[model samples]
Target chain A: MMRVLVVLAVVFATLPGVIVVLASLTAGQSLAFPPQGLSLRWYEVIFADPDFRDALLTSLTLATITSLLAVSLSALAAISIVRYRSRATALIEAMLLSPLAVPHIVIGIGILQLYGYFGLRADLLTLTLGHLIITIPFALRMLITSLAGMDRQIEHAAASLGATPRAILFQVILPQMKMGLLGAAISVFILSFDDVALTVFLVQPGYTTVPIMLFGMAENQVLPSIHAASVILLLASWLGVILIDRLIGFDRFLFRDGPSG
Target chain B: MQVAPAIRSSRLSRRATSLLLLAPTTLLYLTVYLGGLVMVLVMSIDVPPGVDSGGATLAHYRDVFGSAPIGAIVLRTLRDSLATVAGCLLLGVPVARYITASASRWKGIVLMAVLSPLMVSAIGRIFGWIALFGPGSVIADGLTALFGGKPTGLLYTEAAIIIGLTNLLLPFMVLSVASSRAHFEEDMSKAALSLGATPLSVLLQVELPLIFPGILSGALIVFSLSTTNFVTAALLGGSGRDLVGYEIYLDILVYFQQGRGAALAMLLLVVVVALMALAIQTGVQRHEVRDTAARTRGT
Candidate 1:
């Protein structure tokens, strides 16, 4: 019974993705499973469309900026929260994690209204800021776990040798945190890249991320083009997971238990 | 504690430097994120300039609650979220337990399989459902042919929306459950069996209590994600099963009712935060109980 359940779960999980791949291969202009004939026509079409290309570029640019910003901020926040013993630490930690608890729709609406007050409209910058907000908590949490689990003896030894605080952080602590930082960076990039809810409100006309573009296309009509996009994204994300796992052990990063307290 | 003060002053300086490093993120959260949330709260109560000619009123809130259509949408959103959360927990916990009990090599592959869904965007995954369950698709056609049933597309149905949200949120459930499962001691199950308990009884009487906190957290995350989801509910729910998230989107974008939209958004936010707080408080209580038990055992 247990084996059957596990197998069922795996099959169910993979079914949608397999169908998406098969649908993308259909030669029919409209989506139909059990393809009339397999072909790369839709893939060619996606590549040829300047809008699709531009959306992909925009998504890449936005995700890159969001990830960089989230990583740096989270690294600092994680260091402080882990190293400090202060009254404000718990409040600050809760405040940072509050974004995760709140719904993205609310955040999107909030951002729209706030931007309206400043006469700022939805654009790449607003979208980036929104994604950054959502992504920071994940980055911070991961890095904090890494810091908490790290050996403090190296830093103490450096201090005993009369190493400056800056030198200890830069030369000793930073090097040890590399795996954690790399994992956090990859996860943040993925979050920013895959975001749709927050981006839905903040995206402007003529500027759409890949997911937003796919959403627009799906809403207007479900077509083979959307399947092609799904296949590409799935493949890209799979590649990203594998790459990150290779760079830093994925299991350690993911399954690292949080602080006991 | 003499050296502790020197150590504390040095740590304080280090923390200050770290704060400087975190300045940009703090600015983004305060100015862009939290600031935006505050703006939405203010707008929720604000009466549109032309409509009321009055500055602010609770009229929008009254409208949201008083209207049958809007009220039904909120209820449907809550119902669907609860259903999805239940489904994910029922499905995810068993799968996670199976993976945790399996050999180390299988664990990695199983974990990846579970988490791969998180990589795909919700939009793309919903589109995948669109192709599978949309009119004239293989799944729909197969159902009709096999059962000699009417050709009804499952697209734009509440069931389809729930299924999509479950798929999107399942990874979170599995990840949390599996983490907790890893920490379970092997002897508890053996001890139960030695005491003449059946396998099922051992699982229920011993393991379930230990892992309930992780399960609760997973359920809360999944529920919150499903309730707040806009794209799947909008794309799959059609007109019959409008959720609060979809209504907010439609109000702002389609109807141009900014005040109503903000009000709906605020309501959803309040409910979701309250739910989360409740879940966290329960989790903390469980933690305290576990700590007390462990300490008593130690003595």
Candidate 2:
């Protein structure tokens, strides 16, 4: 009975993804599972469409910049959280994770208002800020988790050898946190890449992310090309998960609660 | 115990450097993130210019809560959130136990499989459901053939929303359960079995109590996550439903009702924060227990 339930759980978990892969292969104009005939025609169509092309570029670029910023900023904050023993450190840690407590839809519109008040256009910068607000928490949490379990002996050894702070940081601390850094980088990039709620209100029409664009298309009409778009995203996310498992080990990182907490 | 090498610099300079290290993150979080949050709260109560006399009123809250449909919407949101969490816990506990008990290399592969829905965007996975629940799809078609009735009512319903949210949340639930089991592994169960207790009794009496906190926090997390999501509820659930998430989206973008949207957003924020506080408090309590234990040992 126990084994049966685990099998069932795994099956249900991947069922939607499997259905998507099958649906995307359809030769039909509209979306449907169990395609009439398997074809790559829809994939070709989605790639040709400038909107999908631009949205893909915009999403990747936004994710890249957001993850880069999130990793560095959170690395600094994680040092404070792990290294220091100050009252303010706890406050900072709590505040950094505060965004996870609130709903993303609220943050999305709040960001819209923030930019609107300052007369800032809803472009890449605004989108990056929105993603940053969401992604920073994950980056901070991952680094904090990594730093917490780390042994301090190596840092002490380096300092006792008269190594400079910069050397110890670059060569000792960072190299130790490599897996954590990569995991943070991958998680933040994926979260920022696939964000829809934050992207929806913070995006300009032509400069929107892929999820936002796909959402609009999903809302307006059903198309097999959207399935193709989804299949590509699913594939991309699968690659990230695989990389996470290889680089750091998914069992180590992912068992912590998701960024939702 | 600072990680950086302590230089022989003056006290004030060390303080300044500490401030410098902390300043960037503090400034960004406060100015950009918290500032937006405050803006939303301000917009919620202070009615936009054209709507009313506009003197820091609770009129938006009064307007939102006074309406009958809003009440119904809140109830529906609650129902869906509860149902989704229930579904996730039902499925998640067994899987988490399986992962925790097994020492095989393939357990990592299984963990990845569990998180597949979560790592995939809600939009991507939900679109797949649009296919799965769509007419003439395999599941729908299979049902139609067997039952000899129209294959409908599943798509664009609360059922679909619940299923989508449950799948998205199952990984978290599994992780939480797995985390609790990590500290108390197979030893307890083995000890209980050695005492001649039945397998069923050992699981119920020995293990369930240990992992109950995990289940509680996981349920709360799922409740909070599923309730606040707009995209999954919107696309999978048709526009006819007045989900708080979808309604807030329409309120802000469609009707240009910023005040009401902000009010609704704040309400959702309050509920989500309260649940998260409980969840974190559970975690913090355990950490405090460990800290006190270490302190006692040191003394």
Top candidate, metric lDDT? 2
- Model 1 clash pairs are B156-B236
lDDT of 1 by residue, B1-299 (tens): 79999999977786677576656777777888889888988888887776847667898888888899987887898889888988787778877887677665666676677666776555656667777887778877887888876766677788898888888888888876776566566666887799899999988888898778778878887887788888888877876687888889888877988888888898889889987887777567556656764675569
Q: What is the lDDT of residue A151 in candidate 1?
A: 92
* Best-matching candidate per DockQ: 2
> Residue B283 lDDT in model 2?
62
DockQ of each: 0.56, 0.57
lDDT of 2 by residue, B159-232 (tens): 88999888889998997777767655476689789999999999899788777777888888999998888888
Off by over 4 Å in 2: A256-261, B1-10, B51-54, B104-106, B143-153, B285-299
Local error of candidate 2 at B20, Å?
A: 1.3
